[model samples]
Target: MNKPLAERLRPAKLEDYLSQQHLVGPNGSLQQALKVGIIPSLILWGPPGIGKTTLASIISKESNRPFYTLSAINSGVKDVREVIDKAKQSGGLFTQKNPILFIDEIHRFSKSQQDSLLGAVEKGWVTLIGATTENPSFEVIPALLSRCQVYILKPFSKEDLIKLLRRAISEDDIINKKSVTLKETEALLRLSGGDARKLLNIFELVVTTESTTSVEITNEMVLSKVQQNTVLYDKTGDQHYDIISAFIKSIRGSDPNGAVYWLARMIEGGEDVKFIARRLIISASEDIGNANPTALVIANNCFQAVTTIGYPESRIILSQCVTYLASSAKSNASYKAIGKAQQLVKQTGDLPVPLNLRNAPTQLMKEIGYGETYKYAHDYKGNFVEEEFLPDEIKGTTFYSPGESARETTIRKELKNKWGLKYNY
Candidate 1:
């Protein structure tokens, strides 16, 4: 059997691994854990071709544990139990050397399928190492998620990808048998989109097909050999991220036509409805915000509606929400305000709340004058009162600057009327 370059070059040991130095470096927590022969249940979350599966295999080998594999794409609840039973028999229950069960694309597993894993993992029957390209918080059930430590694997850096190409050239038996020099890598790197597996596959494709014994790689040659454009949407690949970004940017730019076009692309590609709805909700809040609070309400309703109603019918609801958000007046004041406030908090390091802001539930607290100077806003004119609401050290610090949209203009006027430049409105 002929093995692909990616599989042929899979690192069997930690020393041979590339990229993710943060997770596999000397002072890294994961590396430290492996040093002591303590392997905890962990979820490797990141993009495709980033060595999640290879790392799992390395962990199992380094720990000297029985290894089992499953793909959430095909496996079911019954398949999970069968594997758990086999692992239990092989390693015994709650033993120090428990089996390692690696599940790929774990996000595809339904709630019931994930539920079946709860007992075995909790009891230490198998040390679970699941891999996902999606956010585990949204896919993994809370019960199962809480049991595993989530370690994120980042996309391969430019330096790391170059290192992979060099290693493959110098180490691989088939490639080294011929003379090959990497003169340029811009086309290869751009085509791979920071995916190590894709890089290796492209590199191998470019190298092995050369007719001459001596081969020199260049950007032009790489592009000539491989198709430069793709019309099909790969929901799991780079297109997935790129399209979603285009979709949200269109909404933020207030281009309803562009928003609907990207929405149609995703829909035609059979993209997950829940994923589309989630992005709409985020865009409504982060982009539209108080300029049209109704945008958020509509986006949230769209999520619930699409979740309950799957594809073919849910597309209509999504189009409605997308167009509404794209046409709405935009404001990022709330988003920017929170960002500035968070930076201030980090700089200030948790200043104490003002005395009046503290609760005076107990008489003992009341004796200390917790609410002595606290004014009741309703007791004053216009149902408002002026008081120091911020910490003494950070008083009069303004964070919110309302946007110039119609709704926010009204808000700015109201603030100017009430505080009289106290907030510099």
Candidate 2:
């Protein structure tokens, strides 16, 4: 069998693992766990090729515990249950130290899938080590998340990448047989985007593709070799964020063509259908707020439809919603209003509500002036009454300014008429 350079060069021990010193150093967070052989359930969150899997393997090896690996990309609840059952039998049944179960891309697991692991984790049937590139707080269930210690992994620095390249040349038998000198690394590092496995694998490709023993790797040579291999959509790398950025920008810019094109890119790339729909829903509110109130309704409906009907069919519903959002009038008035309100609340902490605005459920509360001088709009003409709504301290503040659109222009006119000089914008 032919093994890739990344797999071949996988570090086996903690001392051999590079970078992530905060998690594994002698004075690191896991120092006691590794030394005393008491492993806790942990969640390792970071960008790809940063040694989450390698660190888990090293911890297992150092602690002399059986290691079970599962990739969330291919594994489901059944696979998780089978592994946990086997782990329970292995050591968790008769010992305090449970076998370590390492799960990669753990963020992809659904709520039910995560719920299934709760019993085993709580009972010490397994010491779980979950790895994810996404933020675990949002992806992992609160119950599951609370049970594990989440440690963030940083990307490898230029100095670390250089060390890895030299180490590969010195250690790997294939590369050691060839005369591969790291003459220039700027192109290699830039293309790899701080991913250690990508950095090493790209270096290997540059060396092996040369077909000659004496090859001095240069920036120009590395770029030429890696240009064709660069992809536009990698869920684990920069392309994932970049493409989504473009998708949102297109919708916000009101370019239906661009929006649909990027949507197709995400759909073709097998992105989580729910993930795409969720972004669309946010964009609708943040980018197209009250300018066209129906946009939010449509975006919400699209989200529900896509969640219920996934894949090839969901693409049509998403495309429809994207075009509608792109064609609608844009405004961030609601988005801005909420932000300003939050800032004001922070500045004026727990300011007392006006007597008119306070609710009085009891006679004593009403006697103390709660609900005093409150106007009933129905008793006034046009069901409108001008009254003190804000606190006396900041009574004349204006937070919600209507955007310039046919719909909001009408709303602004109505407000000015109702408040007279108070809303005389």
Candidate 3:
């Protein structure tokens, strides 16, 4: 009997794991700790198919620890206690050693289930390795979370996914013998959306279905295969990234028609309407700042409406927001300003706060010249007084260059009127 694709390809060691070089690479925190035989209780947080389970297995193997497993989806408090009892019995083998208890989908475990494991973990009877696709801050109880170090696993990069596909074709027992030619891989990679398991599954389906020895995987073939199969639209997986990408690009390209079309795709795919609305809210600020400040307000209101009302009715609210945002004049001045300001901060190190601008909460600071040279803008005419606000090391450093748009034109004119050559770049 052939094992499942996911099972066959699971990385059994750190060397076999594909991405997360920052964590599992040589000299990485996890790798170093494993070498020294000091494995901390940890929580692996990431989206599915990014190899969280594989990492947990690798940790247990490399450390030579007795490993026990549980699933939050199926395991209850009774199961947790059973595992804890087993771990306690196993810990007696060595004076200093304890068993490693790994819990998959730990986010699904209820408060009581998690509470049951606290005593075992606190006593060092077991080193808990918890994996969750959800944010651990919200799902994992504070007490349990505080006991474990959380490591965030990023989605696999394009190169990483490609590497895995090549490995599956060349290394896997089932597909290795068959000759396959990857004519076009962008569509496959894009469709997979950085999910290694999904990439391999799709590859298996494509290669197995074809009759010819040398198979060509094309964009059309991929689309056809996906369409033929049950359209499993994962809100937290590939479809989430793809739909959101299309939605953002539509607004950026100023095509309300395309924007609304993607919006419909997401809605039809059973996407969480609130998730769609949340992305729109972000697009308003990041992609559509200043040019239409009202866009943010409208997007916020749409998000609120979607939260209060759901389903078929919320689609209308989302449509109104998507269209308005796509049609609005767009600028990223505020976003750009922050980016530039952050870069400046990193470049110049920390500069002393200007004396006049410093708050004189204490008499000692006031006597030394805090607020000494300050001039009240409101006290002056038109609430206009130009003085240095930046640190002394970099005074009058211009960061925000307003983009040319109807909305920003007024801002540019006002800036020129007030600061003249000081800010007129």
Candidate 4:
């Protein structure tokens, strides 16, 4: 039997590895460390199919270090200790080389399970390389996290993915035999959502079912294949990306019907309810910003309610949020405002802050005009005052432009009354 395309194409050397140029490229931190023949205890934080495991294997092979693996999901404290004991025996006292222990899904490990490896890691019996989809700060114990350097792996870009597809077509034993023409790669790429493993699987599926080598793959064919395959909802894979995209777009398009439909798809597919809820909360802030402030409050409440009540019942909480956010007025004014402000700061460099807005904790700062012309808005009628708060270079520059929505109408009115043409109200 042939190996899976993802497994077959897994890079065995640093040169074969794609993406993550920052880590494995020339003069990169990992590449530099490899040149010195010193491997640090580290964590690979990223989405699935980005080569965390493959990178660990390459590191161990290239460095000539003994390698051990433990799954945080299935391995216990005893398994951890046994691996440590074996590593110590292999290293001995005089040996400079240490075994590399790679823990997959390290976030799933309990506090006690993680604690078991701390001693071995601290003693240098083994170099720890942990992989996780979650933020290490929240999932990993502080003591263990502090000892290991965390390297983030980004999703593959379109070019990187196209390169992988080309490589698979020419290199893979099974795939190379098949003559296939990729007529439309957008559907395949969109379906895979930057996951190489998922991409290859879909490619293989499409080719295997076709009668000829020169078969053209279409979006319809891809959809039919995916619908037939009823695989588990891999929260770390394509499904996660697809569902979230649908959810966000549904709210953005103001289609409560579509939003609820995607929400149901996620729920029926057994997606992590919390994960869906978290996306909803982010969507509220990002897509529904300012236009409907209540959207965020409701989304946040839905997240809390889903956490308190799990499964079957939580679907209702999710539905309420999806519908409410979809029907509400939508705007990204706050989000765009921050982006504009950030760009201005970068282009203008760090302009000196207005003296009136600066703190005057010391007498020297006050003598330099710090807080000298500051206006206290609270001391004025209706807590309103026209004062120059921005840096002198950007005194009247406007960042936020309120959208033409009901909630923002009030904001537009207030700004028009206060700053008038300064804000182009």
Cα-based TM-score, every candidate: 0.90, 0.81, 0.73, 0.81
Q: How many clashes does each candidate structure show, in the order listed?
A: 0, 0, 0, 1
lDDT of 4 by residue, 336-396 (tens): 8999999999999989888888999999998989999999999999899998878878877
Question: Which one is best on TM-score?
Answer: 1
TM-score for candidate 3, please give it: 0.73
lDDT (Cα, tens digit) per residue for candidate 3, span 1-425? 77766679888879988889889999788999888888889999998789988898899889888999998868999999999999998885333468899999897777799999898888898999999877788678999999999999998888888788788887888886788777889878877777777878777887877887778889899878877774543543457677779889999888999999999888877665656887898899988898889999999999989877888999999999999999989898889899999999899988888899999999999999999899999999999899888886776678887888888888888888888887644
The CA lDDT of each predicted structure is 0.90, 0.87, 0.85, 0.86
lDDT of 2 by residue, 309-407 (tens): 888899999999999999889988889889988898899888889987889999998999888889999999999999988777777777888899898
- In terms of lDDT, which candidate is stronger, 1 or 4? 1
Q: Give lDDT tens digits, candidate 1, residues 86-117.
A: 99999977577999999998987888999999
Model 1 CA lDDT for position 337? 93
Candidate 3, run of 10 with poorest lDDT: 230-239
Q: What TM value does model 4 have?
A: 0.81
